[model samples]
Each structure stands twice: as C-alpha cells, then as structure tokens.
Target: MAVFWIQPATFLAAYYHYFHGYGELIASHAADPSYEVALPGLCQPLRIRDFPSFLVDTTGGEVGKLVNDAFRELFEFMDEQGHGAKFLVNTFDELEPAALAAMRRYLDVFAIGPLVGSSAEARIHLFDHAGADKKRYMEWLGAQPDMSVVYVSFGSIWTYSKQQMEEIAQGLRQCGRPYLLVVRKDGRQEDVSSCLDDAVLKGQGMVVEWCDQPAVLAHPSVGCFVTHCGWNSTLEAMALGVPVVAAPSMFDQPTNAYLIEQCVAGVRGERNGNGVFAGAELARCVELVMGSGARAVEIREGVEALKGMAREAAVSGGRADRNLRSFVTDTTIH
Candidate 1:
C-alpha cells in the first residue's frame, strides 16, 4: 500500500497517458531540445529539457535508455491490467485535483498523503559519521532566531561537482544569510569542503557532511529551503510551511519544481546554458522566496495555505485518511 514514487501524482497521472509520445520526444530532444510540450493537466508548458534526464539522456551511458525500456514494460502491463493496478500516492486531494482526477480516469488512484512528518518527535536520519549526533545541528538551529537560517540540501543520489558546490557556496555568501549546507561524503568532497572553508570561517554558514532533513525543515530557524525539488522534500516543505528555492536536477525533480513555482509556493530558479545555476542566480532565487518583497510575502502565504491543506488531508477525518480507510476495507472484503 505504501508506494515509493518520488514523482508527484500530478505528473504520474500524465505519465499514464502521454507515455506513448515519450520515445519520440526523447529522440527529438537528443537532436534539438528547443520545443515545448503541453501536458494533460498541467497549465505550464514543459520544455524538452525539463523532462526526466533518463528520458532525454544523451550521455551515451545507455542507463537512461535501459530505465526508459523498463518503464515501457511497466506501462504495457498497466495497459493490459487497467484498473487492476492500484497506486497509493503520497499527496492530498486539494493539492492536485486535476492530476488526481486524470489519474483516476485510467486507474484506481488514492490520494493518501502529503505524509508530512513522523509520530516520533525525536526523528533523526541515520547518518554514519561524527555529525550523526542529532543535537549537533539542532543546537545550531536553536541558537538562531526564527526564520533566520536558509537550509540547503540536494538529495542523496547525485554527487555534487566541485564547481557546482563552489557556485552554491558563493551564492550563499552573496545572500549573506546564515545558511546550513549539507554535503555528502560519497567522494570528491574534499575540494568542495576547501571551497566552503572561507564562508564557514566568516561565520556565515555551516557545512555538515549530512544532516537530518526532516528535523531541519521542521526547525523554526529554517526560513527557506534551497532544494533540488525531490518529491518528498517538496511535500515536507509544503507541510512545514517553508518556501523553496527549487534547483531541480533530474528525474521528477523538474516537474516538482514546476509544480511548486506554478502554485506560488516557491520559485524555480533560472539556470544558465551550462546547466549550472551560478552563485548570483542562486542568491537571486533565495531572495525571491526568502526576502521581504511582495512576491516573497505572497510565496510565504501560499506555502502556509498548502501547509494547512497537507495537514488536514492526513488527519483522522480528512480526505487522505478517509481514502486509506476505504482502501483497507475494500481490500479486506475482497
């Protein structure tokens, strides 16, 4: 019953319908990524570059092609199975009505989430290092005033490049905000660490190998989350009422970025042609979502509203709770 789709229900619904065109588009993007395509439920037009990297993968690695073929097989099975394929998505009804509705037309879709936080009050992500002490970062957050720190974390999968890390460090410096940055130790981090030394010495930032993301997002000091826009991170920010500076990298991240920005919950950062978001652009996006400007205020308001919706949907009598109950009952009876 617990599905691990990091992609939102909004795009997953369309994946069931427009999957047929994906191959042609992938080939087209490989040739020239200049065109935009309209999806079924999304109002914003998605350019070829925004599609999952696996689909338009030009790396000659063939990993993208292999992943694409595997998805094609699953799609073929779904086409044969139809409503027999039941998916429990982690999202709320109010959050993505159109996308949910579109999905239900093709299969049995349940909106059972925005599964925001855990029951455990002392939740900590298990990290294998000295920074593993949950109190280490939590203490830092406690020292800062409410809404003073900007939290930056790209998810665990992709290794950040030295240049990419430098750009982000420079951007955080430009923002001149007290920011907490997460850098994984999966290799090639010594150079990145060296780049961040100047900023850490200035007392403007803290760089940890890894941190408990849920706990950090929940902290009062975290004003804005500069994320890669992974689905779980997106939902956590929505539920916790933190505005985002979405720096989507690959997979469903681009679509998630688009969703948050279109909903006015955050700002999807503008990237340069090099596929690298520079330090200056990074600062501009952080300011847009975190500062006191009208758009920033509006983004905060939008985030707060979605926060309530996400909470309500997961509560006892809410839509997601009710849907879960219904699903259990039907499965038990059958």
Candidate 2:
C-alpha cells in the first residue's frame, strides 16, 4: 500500500490494533519493546503545526467530515491484519527523516522518490495538454536573466476563488519581478488574458493555462516559487534548488508549508483571520525569499544544501536506492 506521510501511518497502526484486537500494543511497544524495532521518539521533536489539521481536530464543515470519514475507512483497509501494512512513500530520507524513522516502529515504510524524470528522460505528464508550446515557454525563460523570475502555480487540483487569483496577481505585480502565472481555464470564473490584461500587456508576466512545471522549476531563470505547498511541488522546488513562498490552502499543504519554514527553504505568506491571501503579504514573502537581505541569503544557502542532499539521495547506490533494493529483497524473502 502507498501512504503519503508518517502521521497517517500512525493512524493506520492505531486502526490495525482496533480491528485485530491488539489492544494497547502500540502503548506496550512504546513502554517496553518486545522486538528490536525503530521506535517513535528516536528523532527530534516534530513541529506540531507541520501535521494535517484533521489529525489535530476534525470538526468543521463538509470537507472536514468527508476527510474524517475517508481516513476511517483508509486506516481500516490499511490494517485488516493484526499488523499494519507496509507502505511506499513518495519522499526521501533527508526531507522527512524523523517521521519516516518513527513510523517504522509499526509499519514497514520505504522512502523512494522525487519520482520524476531524469535529465535525459522525457517527463510523463498525467494530464494531456496537446496545444502547449514547450519551446515558446523555454525560450521565454531562457531570455530572462538568471534567477530573475518567479514561478507561480497551485497544482492541477485546488481551484482558487476569484478573489484569491486577483490577490495573487496583485502580489506578483507588486513584487516588480517577471513571473509565470498558471491559471487553468476550466475551474476559474475569468479568462487569464482578461484577468491580467494590463500585466501581460506591460510584459510584467506571462499567464498560461499550463506549462511544464518540472522543466520550469529546473530553469536557471526561476528564482523563487509561489506555491500552494503541495507535496509534489515542495519536492520539485527542493530538487531544483528554487526557494519557495508558500501560500497554503488546505489538507497537507499547511503541513508542507510549515516544513518549508522549518527547513529554511522558504517563507510562508501571511493570511488574514478569514484565511484570505493579501497581496501585500504575498509580495512580502516573495521579497523575503528572493531579495538579497540576510534572511534571503540564509534561505538560499539552506535551499542549495537541500538540493545537494536530494540529488545525492536519488543517485545510483544512494541511500534511496539502497533502501528500495532492501525493500525488494525483503519482500522476495518473505
């Protein structure tokens, strides 16, 4: 089975105990271990905010109810046997070492990813966008100076309200840097051209329905990323050595945003009490990441360090490769 993170894996373990009548097994294991296993608390304290909200308090509107119900069933399926199931996560050791180590106590967890195409391989896009001109975007990016552009995308899912889109546009404009803004046509109330007509005409930014995200992030012109803090996006930014400006919306995004902050790879944009993005705050975050102040320099250094680690983890005979091989070997033996 595939689980995204260790927090959910812990919940799966609890559900396994409930279904298999292994009452207090986790507690007993924690108190007095029967087997030599990598247990929880072996790592440093995790930032409490870097966890999904549902795990903390699941009391809200329809979305919360749906998430809670879905998790309930997912955990049950994950632990049909007395023991929790093994899971393959799309993450690497350096990105979430503590959580990965802690979850190994109850579940056989493997970290194998940044699972995108290599430099020589073609990327496999899940969605079909037959008309996008890759050459045109790449040429535009090439024309820009090194580390001069801000790339903004909120992933394929997660439709933003019109207000949110306007605020983002305003933020990009206020930052006074060239940017590539992606606003998919299907889920929005206005067309990209009409919404950012003045900005486009002024050559301040380029707005598109979709572009190659991995390619864009890897581009030399991309200085900072303005993202919704999705896991894939976070990993991509880390892998490409681009700093981040997180504007988290929901689910795992908030947690990912918190991790970005903890790693000093980026800064989280501030939102109002109503959870609305402010243009000023977005601009501030972009400046904080891309500007040449002391904090920005520190963040840039941190991101560069993480980029090296990510590359090392994914290379041949690296930690991720060895871990994956061991998992395969153990499975065959079992």
Candidate 3:
C-alpha cells in the first residue's frame, strides 16, 4: 500500500526540515518508517552543477546560501532513503525520457503532467482578469502583428541587481523589438526610463508589475517568451504554443532551459560557466534570436506542434491525464 506525498514547491521550509534532517524532524510523529513514504521526484536530481547559475558560487552572497542549503538538504534526504520508496514526478514522459528512464531503476517513477490543467479546477481565479485593464493589455496585444511582442519575465522568485537588470534592458532596447516586461516588486525597480533612450521607448514597450500570465500568453501578439525557465512557466509557455528565450536565473531553471534549447528546439537563450553563454553573450544571443524572422517562424511552428502534443497528453482520454487519475485512485483507494 503506497501513499503519495503532496508537497508544494513553494513550501521550502518544510522541504528543508524533512530533507535536511533525514526525517528526524518528522519521524517522531510519522506513523511508519520514513522509508515507507513516497516522494515527489523532480525532472532531475538537484546538483551543484545544475544549481541556478547564480547559486554555483559557494562563496557568493545570501541567495547562494539559500540555494545551497535547500539543495543540500534535498540530496541528503535522498541519500538516506535506502532506495526503498516509490517516487512520482509530475512531468511528461516525452519531455525527459532519458532522465525518467534512468530514474525507473531507483523508484517507481510516473510522469503525470503539465500540472496547469489541474490549476483550472482550483476555483482560485487567480489567473483570470478583472475587466478593463485586462482588456487593455489584451487589446493592445491584439493590435500588434502576430509574433511581434516578446514576453519578458523572471519567475516570481528571482530578482536582478540593478546593473544586470539594466544591461538586459539595454540589450532589449538595442534589439529594437516590442516587449512586455513584468517588473516584479523586487527592490531592483528603479527609474528604467532614464536608461532607455527615447528611440527605444517609442510607444513600443510596456512594463507591468504583475500580470495574469496564462491569459497574456494566449493573446495573439505574444510570439515568444523571454523566461527564467521555471517548470510551470515552461509548461504554460508550451501550452500556449509560444517558443522561448530561456534566460533561466535560479533553481531548476537551468535544467528546464537546457531541455528546451538543447534537447528541444522550442527554447533559446544562454548558459553560464562550462564555456557556455553569459550575460553579454546572452544579450547577443537574444538579439540573434529575436532578429531573425525565419527563426521565429521556426520556433512558432515547433511550439505549435509541441502544444498539440501537450494538449493530447492533458486532454480527457490521453495518457498523462489518465495516468494522473490512476495514480490518485491507487494512492487513495482503500
């Protein structure tokens, strides 16, 4: 009798407690041995190499400490588990067949999503729009030519230093492309209008504090996503048939970026360290990607193809949706 675990990715404190102490924190109250617990598997194991480009520097600042400690805890827990537990990951078999296949030896791995499909049923209405403001964004987008606007957002978590942020802004300005920027309320928000020259701001760009992302992507003008490569964002972007410029900053972002740009054709962006892409290099890369209408066309077509596949996987009778239901049944059945 296997019982599934349900933990939110946002609940890092709990993750730290369970993983860092090897269940010693929870074992006192646990009904059975910790080895009997089933865990949620990631698309890949957390690794120093795979840490967000920012976290790779152990000698770096606070964010590094946070990233390092969290992953350290996670791996430590995995090491203590004795390979006796079943693991289920909410990913698709198609997205990472190799990693999933390798994981099968160590755990009863099941890839059961694009979990956004579940978000629709939550009654949260978190992603839905209000009224006029929503329509204004959407209508502005609708007026633009197809694939004209580049959507730029770092996932809710990551923040950029002012210098780094402006460099990106400069790059975008230099690229001479229309963009929608999501300036999350990190401390980094400054007078960016000063940095961008008049020519660059000629009614071409819009910056919003937060947006209903799923709705925005569904808009006709959103051609590509310049993203941090969060798995949820990746899935959502793919679901919208939008190709990506994967500017991943932290966490599993690099892993997701690699999957898109290297493994799949729908993503393009930078890699840092190991003789890959850096910030300036990434700027160049972004320019090259956005400059080419042909490449954009290719990415759009590829995303559309991927979207069709994702739709089938999440639709009522498909393998992914059915597997998710089956897993729930098996775990919940008496």
Error of 1 at 318 (Å): 1.6
Q: Enumerate clash totals for all models, in the order shown.
A: 0, 0, 0
TM-score of each: 0.90, 0.83, 0.70
TM-score of 1: 0.90
Q: Across residues 139-252, which tens digit of lDDT does each residue of candidate 1 receive?
A: 988888899898988876657778888898889889988999887778354467677676585666788877777779889999999988888889989998899999887777
Ranking by TM-score: 1, 2, 3
Q: How much lDDT does each candidate structure score?
A: 0.78, 0.72, 0.59
Model 2 vs truth, CA RMSD: 6.4
lDDT of 3 by residue, 1-334 (tens): 2323222131222243345453452443333211232223444333333333433343457876676576676556665664543455656666556555655555455566666643333435433233325556667777788777878877666665555566667666766668777765452456554544432487788776567788788878776787877888888887778778887655566656656754344554645454333456545655545557676566656777778777877778786777777767765653
Badly placed stretches (over 4 Å) of model 2 are 1-49, 56-59, 77-84, 118-126, 190-193
Candidate 2 lDDT, 1-334, residue by residue in tens: 5455433232333333333454333323332312223224334322333444443332456876677578668767776643446677667778777666766766788887656564423765655677787788889999899999999888888676767777888888899999998877775755545456755647778888778888899999999999888887888898889999998776677667867877899998867767778888989998998998999999999999989988998999987798889878877776
- In terms of TM-score, how similar is model 3 to the real structure? 0.70
> Candidate 3 — what's its lDDT?
0.59
Sort by lDDT, top down from the best: 1, 2, 3
